[model samples]
Target: MKAAIIGGGVIGGGWAARFLLNGWDVAVFDPDPEAERKIGEVIANARRSLPALYDTALPAEGNLSFHSEMADAVQNANWIQESIPERLDLKHRILGDLSELAPETAVIGSSTSGFKPSELNEKGARAIVAHPFNPVYLLPLIELVGDAGACENAAPVLRSIGMFPLMVRKEIDAHIADRFLEAVWREALWLVKDGIATTEEIDEAIRMGFGIRWAQMGLFETYRIAGGEAGMKHFMAQFGPALKWPWTKLMDVPEFTDELVDLIAGQSDAQSGHMSIRELERLRDDNLVGMMRALKKTGSGAGGVIQRHEADLPKPEAPDLPITGDRKIPVSWTDYNGHMNETHYLEAGSLATDRFMELIGADANYIASGKSYFTIETHVRYLSELHAGNRLTIRTQVLKGEGKKLHLFHFLYGPDDTLAATVETLLLHVDLTTRASSLPDQAVAEKLGAYHQAHAALEQPEGAGRSVGQKA
Candidate 1:
């Protein structure tokens, strides 16, 4: 798949990175002489963070190209995204040209935060509002509006690239999310203008409070929980009258006076000017990845989107032995030493053991049937240091697989195929209902015997059957 990015500013560069990282050839058209460098930096940030969100590896990155001519960029593109300035005339001109130049089947998307699809298509441009949040590579929501057919076509494509496409039933200005954001923004501006809060304090008010709630559960759902036993109705009845109260200045616009600008900018500078823009971006991305990964455990909000996308990602093919675990080391796995903590080595080995169990039909279903393997012992030999962001691969070899016993050896290879670690594990087949030693099922035992027989022919691993302090 190929994507054409019409502008290479921050948002445009984000779009390009989102596509390129997802294995789509991306062609960017921007007259800015510095566009390439800027986009490259954005992609660099993306490379460091996007893959960290997944336990499985993303596809190999696709090719990226820059074009001086918009016509060249849009040629043969599967998707064309317009991200120029929010000027209607400029959008009409570019989008109209895109309609003529792009493939008829190509989905033309506008990253306009405020403009409606109808307004964008007013000048005979068949464009849809595929508005995405900032740092598009990480944030999953894309508010899609316009032609129903176009949106329906875009949703799967967006999902294929790990995005959540929300189709707006009505073409409202600013779509859905931004409208609510605009209201909050207006109230914030009033507070700042009235000297009720500083920029930092106002930001703290959001980030320390509702921001976290909203990340996992949106406004309505959060409110529904707030409703208590009676649900949304109880909460609404209690606080509904407050809606008409003069508590907020959302309807009143704060004048964009120079003094107000200085006040906000100065306060913001004082608050966070120490960090460079790139530094701030990396910080934000790290926080987002960590939070989203936490959410993945519960399949909440963005985490659920990631979990679904990960299920579709192709698993790594095994060589002679099964490649049980393949993944990037996220920052959370590192410790004060700036390398992977010792605890995670066992965690990785446990995951590999789980996968191996599945291979032998001792999987979730088998466990639910009151039979499973319980790890009784493990010995991990740390060969070398593994750091965060390193790609780790674990290959498993069955040392012994007989009734009531399963012994396995795992080879942990780092990015350079270096012998980073080795894990020797021993398990016992057990009856979950009785909580006692038991023989494996006939089918599972057959599969395990086959693997054990095949692996028995191979030479024993160097660290096999060794105690913790045993010499090499």
Candidate 2:
């Protein structure tokens, strides 16, 4: 797929890096003379952060081209993302031009804060408001509002690049998030205006406590959990009365006078005196990636989404026998015969099968407690000689999995789909402590059964393991 990003500053470049790294060609448009340098910085950071989110290798980077003309950037684009300045008239002009040059099949998204879709469509051209945060590649929440069709149309494409599109129920100023942010900003201003805490101190308060929880589970949900064993109602009954406290004026707005702005600027500068903005941004990105990956361990909402996205992400095809890491036959695997050792061929095949099993949720944890499939019998037929680094893959199929036993068949193939060997194994579930034949746990049985059921329709291999009850 191809994506076009307008306004080639930090956000635009982040989007470009994200799409390009994920195998989408990206074209960028920005009139600024410094676009190349600015975008390069963002891409540099993205290159480090995005890949750090995954363990497997990614597809090769896609092509990226800069365009001075908006039309040139958007030509033949499946998606057009606008990240220009937040001025309304500027957006209207760009939207009008995009609507004219881009095809209807292309989804147009705008990164606008506080501008309603209604306001943004003043020229009678509809575009979705897709307000992605700065460092657009890292933080995945995109506020989407416009034609319902537009949101539905763009959600999957947004998801493809590892973003979550959140749709607002109705068009409102600043959309859903900024309202919360504005509230906090107002309160923080009041605090700073009275010198209650410094800018850095406020940030410290957030990062040390609720900020961590909010990363995995957002505010309201966490509060709901805090409501206790009885849930929301119980918590509300216990603490909702604090809402009427005379000590606080909840809705008062402090004036954004010059004094306040200067104070904030001075304090923030002092707080971040050590790091340049670019350095700080890189720091933020590194931290976000770490937190998100840690969250994925728990299968939290966003973490689970990333986990699923990574799951569906395609692994590169392995090169032809002895399929190992990076599709390159390792030097150590070579033997005195100059071909890979025979045992290592089986070892490689086992490794490939093991990797495949882990992909489907079987791993050491599932096997360590003596709840593993023990091979009861095996038949391997070598059809062709394999030299060192001669490529190989195993095409495997389940022959039978009924009650307590399973039958599996594998065909080892080399380059040009040449058949090199075949393996068949009959397996039994056993308890590790007693080493006795045993029935699989219900969950294990169900998983095996599901796999067996899914592959039940395949044709039988040329040779299969003999049943214990039937003689050859």
Candidate 3:
């Protein structure tokens, strides 16, 4: 598929990166002379961060081109995303031009924070408000507003690019998330104006407090959990009355005087001015990757979306070798030495074992039937250091596969084709409920025996039989 981005600002570049990295050819039209440089920078950041969120490799990136004319950009586009500034007139003009050239089936999405669909559709254009948060390549939530059919048509396409599309039932000013964000912005401004907190203090309050909760559990669910056994009703009944208090200036406004602006800017500068914007962006991406990976482990919220998507990702093709894993080392797996931690070797081995189990017919369906392989013993030899961001693969050999016992040997090779680590594992087929070893089914046994026989002639690796002791 081909995507055309009508602007090349931060949000627009992000859209380009998201679609381009997902294997969609992208054409971006922006009048700015520096649009290409800026969009290239955003794509570099996206390349580093977005793919780190998953264990499997993303599809081969699509082609990217910059165009000066709107007609040239949207000529063969399947989706046209308009992320010009917030001005409605400019958006209407761009959409008018886009609608004229774009394919009839093309979905036109406007990244307007405050405008409703009706407001944007005034000139008989069928543009939809497909508002996405900043760093669009990473964040999954997108608020979509438009005709039901248009929104519905865009939903799967958005999801196909690893986005969560929230189609608004009714259009309102600022949509949903931005409305909540606007409320917080107003309150934070009031706090700064009232001398209650500095910019850094307010940021710390959010990051150290509810911000983490909001990532996995949104406002209502977090409050529901806080309500104990009674849930949301009890929590609302207890705290809803506090809404009448003057604790927040939700309805009030703060003057955007030069003095106020300088004060906030000065505080922000003092807080995080040391790092360059690129450095800060990398920091933010690293944190997001870590947090998202944790959420993936638990299968909740945005992390759950990533986990499900990763499961559907196609496994990398292997040659004649019995390949178990083909993925990059996530930054979260690195230790203080700037290389992969010792524990992660075992983690990688465990994942390889999972793949091996699937190869032998002990898949999800089999495991769900109360039978699965349980690793009883594992020994890992770390031959060399493997750093974060390194693409690696695990090669496996079945040493024994009979009765209820399975012995496997795995070799982990780093980016340079050097063996970074080796793992030897012993597993037992067991009934999960009984926790006792059990005979493998005939089909599973046959597959395992085939692998064992195929690998029988291979010589043992150097560290295969070593024990933890000094030679006398």
Candidate 4:
């Protein structure tokens, strides 16, 4: 799991943080003296944000080294991620060097946003266009297009690094992301040039509303939902007429002259002039991570991608009833109330248990099939007060899983690893379609059985449920 990142710019640094934090050894090569300082800032932001996006335990940070020589960085690495600036001959030279030094073992991935792999590999190297979005540490979509052989080999490698490789069946200039971005870019020019909207207003229009929906469900899927009960066919019948409107010229492409680039860049600056590039990027990454993780619960596109990642990832083999953490307070859980309110604390404990369940392998698609297990019964003993800033942790164990029910014991801890509360809950797998009491399928039963076999056997709790939760 060694990765060599050539040309350590913003994208290169992002790839470094992503691979390093995800338990892959990462070495970076960029002769620029400022590379260290710039990459360090990127990694610092990446460190705080990436881990917080997930409740499950992340892989340990792996080895990182910076080399002056490209060959030194490329050697012995399983994946060579290239993120140099957008210049064809420069990339060819580098790819030629990479192809010679580490030709067979590692996959050569280009961060080139626009160029096709065939054109890029004119120097006779097997390369895949692994075009990742700006913050490679977050946005999971990596537009991959290249030789079929290269893609076949690279898919599993990309997955190991927590990337979603959407294979473009044909070679096209600017690939997927940049192509869509170009459409917006063209229209945005029209808006700004015509004074129809200010640059900032246009961005706000996007970021504030429809932009949110696009993350979970992209354009076609979003349109499918807008179509109502009858779905896409109905939607098309209703709205397809609007395509002829003067509202848009879908075929228009803006000339990227100096005037246009400056216009857009000028507007962007005025829109976000208060923040530095680093600050803006950090804010962007944080927002993207939060939104994407929220979407992951539904096992939507990026969510489904994350769902699979959390499945293959390994967790520390702690005690069967291990107290992984115990803390006095965290600022996030506290509301305006001096004492912790009821719902958030339940949320916190449930989050901890959910992570535990994920560690034991209950994933989104598993829960999505309308046969999810839910907390059917619960008795919470809040022994000590919880404040806004009071840190808390929970200990959990499967007390029993008999027939269709699960008895669980949760011990909440505060400062000094002291017990704050004890919650005993019963869970049931109900048929999502029928909303009726139902036993879990054998696959789930076997997983629960494994947990039962791993832990010390115990009797069913006194209050295990024969029915669903009141809310359920």
Candidate 5:
């Protein structure tokens, strides 16, 4: 698919990175001469962080081009995103032009934070509010508000690129999330202006407190837990009355005076001026990846979004042995030596074994039927070092497969196509309830037999069945 980015500032660059990293060819039309450099930096950050969020590799990055003319950028584009400044007249003019030039089937998404779709389309344009948070590649939520048909068309496309399309039920100012954000933003400004909390203190209060809760459960769910066995109704009865109290200046707006700007900016500089913006972005991305990965375990919030999207990613295919595992080495998998930790090699092998099991019908359903393969033994031979970001591919060969026993050989190849590692494993079919060895199901046995026969013709993999410290 092709995406046209009508602007290439921070948000525009982020949209481009999100589309491009997901294997969509991106054409960017930004008048700024430095747009390419700026977007390249954003993509560089995305390339490091986005792939780390997944256990499997993302699709190969698509082509990127810079166009001087808007018409050239939108040519044959499937999605056209406008990320120009937030002026209504400017958006109207640009979106109007885009609707005329873009393909009839194209979906035009405006990255407007505050404007409603009705206002955007008033100038005879077909545009939807596709507001995404900063670092759009990693953040999954895209608030979509517009024509029902357009939103329906965009939702699947957004999902394909690993985004969560939240369809707004009605046209409202600032859509959904931003409305809540603006509320908190207003309160925070008041706190800063009224000598209550410094910028860093407020940030610490959030990152060290409710921000973590909000990341996983959001408002109502977390409060439900706080209800202490009585749930939301009881908690609301107790604390809902506090809503009338003047605990927050949520409805008040802090004047944007020069002194206030200087106070906040100066305090912020003191708190984090040592690091560059890129450094801060990297730190933020790393933290988000770690948090999101943790959430994946429980299918919480953005983590659940990632899990669903990963299920749809294409499985790798090989002509001989199947490509059971294909992914980039995330930074978290590394050790003090700046290379992939040894434990992860075994983890990768285990994942490959799981995939191989699924290939032969020993999948979730079969396991749920009280029959599954349990690894009895494993031997790993490390041939080369793997560093973070190196792509790893595991090809499996079914060495022996029979009624109750299974033997497999896995070849782990690094980015250079060199032999990085080898894992030899043995597993036995078992009844989960009894925890005892059992005969494989007839269907599973037949599938395994076919692979075993096909692999019989190939030469014995080197170092297979080798004992520890043995000579080659």
Candidate 6:
């Protein structure tokens, strides 16, 4: 797939990085001479962040080119994105030309935050609003508004690049999320103007309080829980009267004077001047990853989207050895020493055991039938240290497989071909309902037996039969 980016500003660059990283050839055009350098910086940050969100590596990145002419950029593109300055005239002018130059089948998306589709299409330009959040490569939400058929056609393409396409039922100014954001922003600005709170304090108020809740439960759901056992109606009944109070200046706009601008900018600098923008971006990405992973376990909200996407990603087709877990060590998995934590070796082994079970017909369906493997013993030997971002591969060797017991050994190697760890584990099949040892199903037993026979000629790893003791 190929995507053309017509403006290489921050948001446009982000769109480029997203498509390029997801294996789409990208052609970018911008009048700014420094657009290539600026976009390259964004791509650098994206490379560090996006792949860190997944356990497996993303597809090999697609080709990227800086085009000198708009016509050349859109010549053979599958998708064309317009992220020029948010001026309707500028959009119409460029889009009018784009419609004439680009293929009619190509998706034309506008990253316009304020303009409605009606205004954008007023000049007979068939463009859709595909407004995405900042750091577009990381955040999944993309507000899609336009023709039904066009939006529907773009949905799968957006999903292919790990984005959530929120097709708006109706065309509205500023779309959905930004309307809410503008309200909060207006309130925050007033608070600063009235000297009720500083910029940092206002940020703290959100990040330390409702921001976390909003991430998973969103607004109505969070308040519904706050309503206690009675539900949303009760909560609305209790707090709806407060809406009339003069508590907030939501309807008021603060004067945008030079003094106000300087004051707000000064306060923001004081709040986060210690870190570079790159440093802050990394911090934000790490926090998002941590929170999203926590949500993944519970299968809720944004985390659920990530979990489902990860499932859809095709497993890396390495040669079919029992090598189940192959991935880069995430930054979150490291300790202060910048090395992978001690416990993750066993975690990787556990993942391999699950994969081995699936390969032998002891999958989710089989386990649902009241039979599953339970680890009875495990021994891990640290051969060497592994640092964060190190690519690791696990190779499994089946030692024994019988009626109810299976023994296996896993060897973990780092990028440099050094053996980093070894895990030896023993498992027993059990019936969940009866809480007793169970004979393996015939199909599973046959598969396990074949694997055991295949690995029987290999010598046992030195660490496997060793007991915990000091040599005399």
Q: Which 10 consecutive residues of model 1 have the lowest summed lDDT?
A: 311-320
Q: Scored by CA lDDT, what does every candidate get? A: 0.93, 0.76, 0.90, 0.77, 0.93, 0.88
Q: Candidate 5's residue-wise lDDT over 149-221, tens digit each?
A: 9999999999999999999999999888998988988989999999999999999999999999999999999
User: Per-residue lDDT of 1-472 in model 3, one digit per residue for the tens?
Assistant: 9999999999999999999988899999999999999999999888878888887777788999999788999987899999999998987887888778889999999999999999898997889999999889999999999899999999999888888999899999999999999999999999999899999999999999999999999998999999999999999999999989878888799999999999999999999999999889889988998999889889898998798777776776353457888877888899898999989999999999998898889999999988999999998888888987777789898888889999999999998889999999999999898999899889999999988888888887777766766242
Stretches of candidate 2 off by over 4 Å are: 246-251, 319-354, 358-472
Model 4 Cα lDDT, one tens digit per residue, 1-472 = 8999998898999999989879888889998999989888988877756765554546878988999988888888899998999999998988888889884878999999999898988888778899998788887888889988888888888887678988999999999879898888778878877778988898789989989888778899999999999999999999999887888754786566898678878888878899998889877866776677777778887878777887676644455664433333433344577666666566666665565555544556667877776886676666677763344667677877667777677777776666766677777767889988798778778877777776656554433342334341
| Comparison by lDDT, 3 against 4, better one | 3
Off by over 4 Å in 1: 368-370
In candidate 3, stretches whose alpha carbon ends up further than 4 angstroms from where it belongs are 468-472
Question: Which candidate ranks first by TM-score, i.e. highest?
Answer: 5
Candidate 5 has which clashing residue pairs, if any?
Answer: none
Better of 2 and 4 by TM-score: 4
lDDT by residue for model 6 (191-308), tens: 8988989999999999999999999999999999989999999999999999999987877899999988999999999999999987998798788877877787787877777777
TM-score of each: 0.96, 0.73, 0.95, 0.78, 0.97, 0.94
- Roughly what TM-score does model 2 have, to 2 decimal places? 0.73
Better of 4 and 5 by TM-score: 5
- Which pairs clash inside model 6? none
